[model samples]
Target: METIHLTYPETPDVVPSVMVLGFFDGVHTGHQAVIRHAQEQAERLNVPVTVVTFDPHPKQVLSNKPDAVRYITPLSRKLKRIESLGVERCLVLTFTKELAGLSPQQFVDDYLIGAGAVHVTAGFDYSYGKFGEGTMETMPFHARGRFTTSVVNEQTEGGEKVSSTRIRKLLGAGEVDAAATLLGSPYVICGEVIHGDARGRTIGYPTANVVMDASYVMPRLGVYATRVRLRDGRTFHAMTNVGRRPTFYDTGDVSIESHLFDFSEDLYGQLIEIEWVRFIRNERAFDGLDSLIAQLKQDETTARSILS
Candidate 1:
């Protein structure tokens, strides 16, 4: 797909394209439906399928507690997922105070019209412009003679709407299977391996420490069965932990540590993606190093069995 970063007054020259717009955080089933509709429309119209999304989610800019809000998929992962959907192009707009101040009509004129969109597709609940004044009712008026608008209804799974918020809740509660159903894939957190205290190595199960970015939502603190994909794209079944080592000392820093089963190699500084498969148990303080090591061994066995 031809992905581009767009800004007001610096829009691309492509025109008469079918465009899909939204945060598309996790690119969940609902997001997929909208993208599919846009792609189908583009195919029928013989135009390019373009996706419009924002970077640093608007919520981060508008919320008072922006730092506290977590994301279902970081920008990199979101782009990968969207590209996998076969869209011809993706445009990421940088959300800023000045851009956020644009009125609904101005947003349409500046972005939709400027991007040369002949038609636009988005979720039914999608909104835009300063203070979110843009709505389904207002889209057509804003488009006027410039473009057409289509709204895809909310996608439901088991009688409930599939959404990034709901998926995050499921993941935070350790409901990996449910989150997967909503996400259309396993919930993954990827980051570069960083230096750690080397405590896991002393226990015979060396672990790769992943330093998660603040944008990504973290799963419940506990041990889980996971699949680790390395930078080389090779995936390995593994056991993962998200917590502080209470048995050793109370540092209070939440760490995501993964032990690749039966695999050992230098991994520091390499990007690793961890896919959660199942929840094993909640994190707890052990009596001593020996007890913790024993529990880790048990967790490894459980993880292997679950992955198998």
Candidate 2:
């Protein structure tokens, strides 16, 4: 799929296409429904399906506190997920202070009309404009004859709404199964493998330390059963730990370390994706190196059995 990182100057050249607009974090089931609706509309109109999303999530840009900057899928993963939905093109609007200041009418006039959107789709609760002044109530008026709008209702599972925030909370609590049901797939973290202290290597289980992007939401601190995909597209069963090495010292910095079973190769600087399947055990401090090694052996056995 084509990706366009849009600023004010780069307007879409396409004259008439069905467009879906949202942050689309996680590209969860609800976001998929909106995209699917847009795709069907595109099919009927004989036009390409375009997904319009924002970068550096609006909350992160607007918030004052550091902890407010959490995201379900980073930009790269977000693009990949959108592509997987069969979108013909993705327009990533760089969310700037000026863009955020656009009024409800100005946004439609500048983005929708300027970009040549024949039809637009969004979720039921979607809002836009400065301080979220725009709503479904006001969008159609702004569109007028220039475009048609479709608002998809929220997707629900187990009588609850499927949302990025809910999914993040679930994953943070080590509820992988629950999160998967809402996400329509396993929660995945894609990152580049970086150097570590070689703690796993000394124990005869050298690991790949996955350094995730800052925007990606990390799962709970625990040992998990996961599937690792290498840059060359090979998949392997793995056990991943997300925590600080409390036993060794109390630095308290969290890390994601993965031991790919039956695999031994230098993965430093390699890009990899890890798909969390299940949570096995919470992170804890062991007495010493011997105790930690013993626990790791037990963890390997449990992880292998679970994956098997």
Candidate 3:
């Protein structure tokens, strides 16, 4: 897939394409449905399916609590997910105050008309333009014969709409397995294994400490059964904890530490991804190292059963 990053006032010059537009945070099942529908339309039109995504999140620039934003799939992962859906081209427009101030027509003209979009597909609720005033109902009026529009109705699971917000709620509550059902894949934490205080080694568990990006959504603070995939193309059953180590000392910074079962080689500075399988227990302080070790042993057994 070909990906391009562009700002307002600049659009690609190519054959008119079928475009799907959204922030696509998780690229969850609902998002996939929209893209698939676009692909179908693209095939019928004999045009490639293209995607238009926003960066820095519109909320990041528009929200009062911009700092509170976290993402299920960061830009890098989002691109991978989008490409996996067979989108032939991706146009990423950076969100800025100037862009946010664009009137609905200005946005449509600059992004859609300028990009040579012959057909567009998006979710029923997708909106754009200043204050997000653009909607599927309004898109046709804005297109003015320049393009046709398609709307993918809301996709539901368990009688509720599948959305990135709902997925984030599941992760926040440590319902990762539930989140995966909606996401069509496991909820993953991507980061690099970094140096730690070496405390787990002293306790004999010897965990790998992952250094994750600050903008990624985190699962609830607890021990979890996980599967670890190494950058070198290896995977292992693992267990993880996400919390401030109250038993040791509280700096208030959350730690992501995982112990890969049957692993014994050095891993400092290596990159890995952890897929949350199930929550095990809340992070709690134990009496001392002995109690911590015993609890970890139990966690390992439970994790093994789940990963098995």
Candidate 4:
């Protein structure tokens, strides 16, 4: 697949494309349906299936929120997933203030027409232009005889719409097993292994302190069964904890620590990925070190049962 980070005003040279348009965060099931529909259109039109997407999330750019915005799949991961879906080309637009100011007609004229889009596919609720006045219904009106449009009606899983928001909620609620159903795979957390206070080691369950993407949605603060994959392609079942160390009488900063089963190697500074499997239990402060160790042993047993 070819990736073109649109450098604004100038459109790339291209063949007539069957374009799939959306933010497509997580590329969750509904987004897949839209792209898949575009793929079908591309086959019929004998054109490449191209994706028109945006980065940094429009919400982060356009609105103020109480908390930091999070992504289900960051841009790099999103593009890879798009490529895996058999898309031939992807134009990732930077959601700058200038781009956000484009009128519905201008977006249709510049991005759609400029990209040589002969046919376009998007979700029924997709909107464009300044303040999102351009909607799927209005998209054809903006096409102005230049292209055809296809609006994929809501795609559902278990009778509910499959969406990035739904996935985020699932992860936030620690419902990873259900989230995977909508995502078609386990959610991954990529990070660097960093040094900790070596608290787990002293308790005989040394863990890798993973510094993950702060902009990505994290599962609820708890212990979960996960698989840790190393850069060297090694993978192991693991018990991961996401919480502050209250028992150690420490600060309240959240942390991600994973104890790999039967694994011991210097991992500081190593990049790794964690695939969340299932939520185990809520994190809590134990009365003493011995109690903490006892609970960790139980957690490992429970995690192994789920992971194995």
Model 2 misses residue 207 by how many Å? 1.4
Q: All models: lDDT?
A: 0.88, 0.88, 0.91, 0.89
lDDT of candidate 1 over 36-123, digit per residue (tens): 9998999988999889999888878788988887888888889999999998788888888878999999888888898799999899
Of the candidates shown, which would achieve the greatest TM-score relative to the real structure?
Answer: 3
Model 3 stretches with alpha carbons more than 4 Å out: none
Q: What lDDT would candidate 1 get against the real structure?
A: 0.88
Pairwise TM-score winner, candidates 2 and 4: 4
Using lDDT, rank the candidates from best to worst. Answer: 3, 4, 1, 2
TM-score of each: 0.96, 0.95, 0.98, 0.96
Tens-digit per-residue lDDT, 45-133, candidate 2: 99998888999788666778746677778898899999998998988999877889989888888778888999988999998888889
Candidate 4 residue-wise lDDT, 1-308, digit = tens = 99988756757665699988899988888888888899999999998988999986877777787258888898988988889998989998888778889899998888888779899889999999999999999988899988999889998899888998899999999999899999988998899999999978877999999998547898999999999999999999999999987887567788899999999899999989999999999988889988998999999999999987
Q: After superposition, how far is residue 294 of candidate 2 from its true place, in Å?
A: 2.7
lDDT value, residue 38 of candidate 3: 92
Candidate 3: residue 224 lDDT (0-100):
98
Show the colliding residue pairs in model 2: none
